[model samples]
Target: MASDVRFSDSRVGVSTPLDSLREVLGVPDLDTALLTHALTHRSYAYENGNIPNNERLEFLGDSVLGVVVTAALFRTHPDLPEGQLAKLRAAVVSAKALAEVAIELQLGQHLLLGRGEETTGGRRKASILSDTVEAIIGAIYLQFGIERASEVVHRVFDPFIARAAEMGAGLDWKTSLQEIAADHGLGVPRYVLEGTGPDHDKTFTAEVHLGGERLVVVGAGAL
Candidate 1:
């Protein structure tokens, strides 16, 4: 891997942005162009005589991200139904989630924005952050294969996965209602669940009662 491309060798500049990113990502032997391309936005690319941007890499990374998240979800949540698993996956791979990860990585600091974008606060934009995160993933995958890329993804998103798992559980109304009730010092919520109609077209209703509370919140769903 070290010999695969031209190493920086201090040719560009000392204490450069790439050096900072290399140290942050712990990939000392990373290909310069790969990382540079990952950091380059379309505006910067156009400004620099139409040099390549990260969009292509972002596209590739989207699929890589999906595979990584899907495999992790499948392994970790084997008991969850397919629908629930999909929801969890969607939450984790969402643009907002990726942008949050990018913020944690401080990737915005390394972006190569054009003058106009820089003036417009492009560094803090969620779209740019999320797209760059995916591009970085693509670059890592191309350089070190999926195993290393998966490691990077996991390292960057471990906290996010934990939060997403909690959010996924909250999708169950009973669980959320119970948690909310407990938070409000209302003890556990009691629910009287009932259903109507045939199996093919059934409507279910849940009447929830909190401790010492006269108000009842009714939730309904169809199966």
Candidate 2:
């Protein structure tokens, strides 16, 4: 899609019309009107006044996604204990994974955003994309049912699941990070400035640390 597909204010659209999304998602009968609502973000809704955001659908989709992910985990890991199942669930629903799926579906291009969000680049944000993805799943479940939502989820999550299985080990990065931070009695790690450059060009250095030991990562870009 073209970059010009900016959100109405700057949040809801940056892609071609959602007519194509239904085709990509394989839900031929999925109502386009609902999709308009699905794509509408609260920020955009506030500006329009006539339309509402996808929040309610997002709320519904959150639970639907949980159910779909849990059910898949249960069916796939019949032998694994609860701990393992929880790990798989986390892996499937992680912000990273959902954002990846949203990208795969090209969903980000269709988001509706308020001008503030658009000017600030809300389109590529993981939190917004992930929440919108979940909301879409919920909207599907409501319009159809678990069967449709599950089918779509399976199709959407297939690559992620296959990759995880190939890794041949349980995913525990987030979990391990928590324990390691706690063991060192670190309340939380934060970023502190570490450099400078010209007005249009700059750099950032962030440190994730526990006690006196810190891991610093530096990145450079333009505002």
- Give the winner by TM-score: 1
- Model 2 per-residue lDDT tens digits across residues 72-183: 7787778866765677777778888999999888887899899988998899989889988987886778777889988988889877665654332457544555655676
User: For every model shown, what is its TM-score relative to the native structure?
Assistant: 0.70, 0.67
Cα error, candidate 2, residue 7 (Å): 22
Q: Which residues of candidate 2, in runs, are more than 4 Å off?
A: 1-16, 165-223
Q: Each model's C-alpha lDDT? A: 0.81, 0.72
> How does residue 1 of candidate 2 score in lDDT?
46
- At residue 32, what lDDT does model 2 achieve? 59
What are the per-residue Cα lDDT tens digits for candidate 1 across 113-167?
A: 9999999999999999999999988888887889988988888876767677776
**What TM-score would you give candidate 2 relative to the actual structure?**
0.67
lDDT of 1 at 53: 89
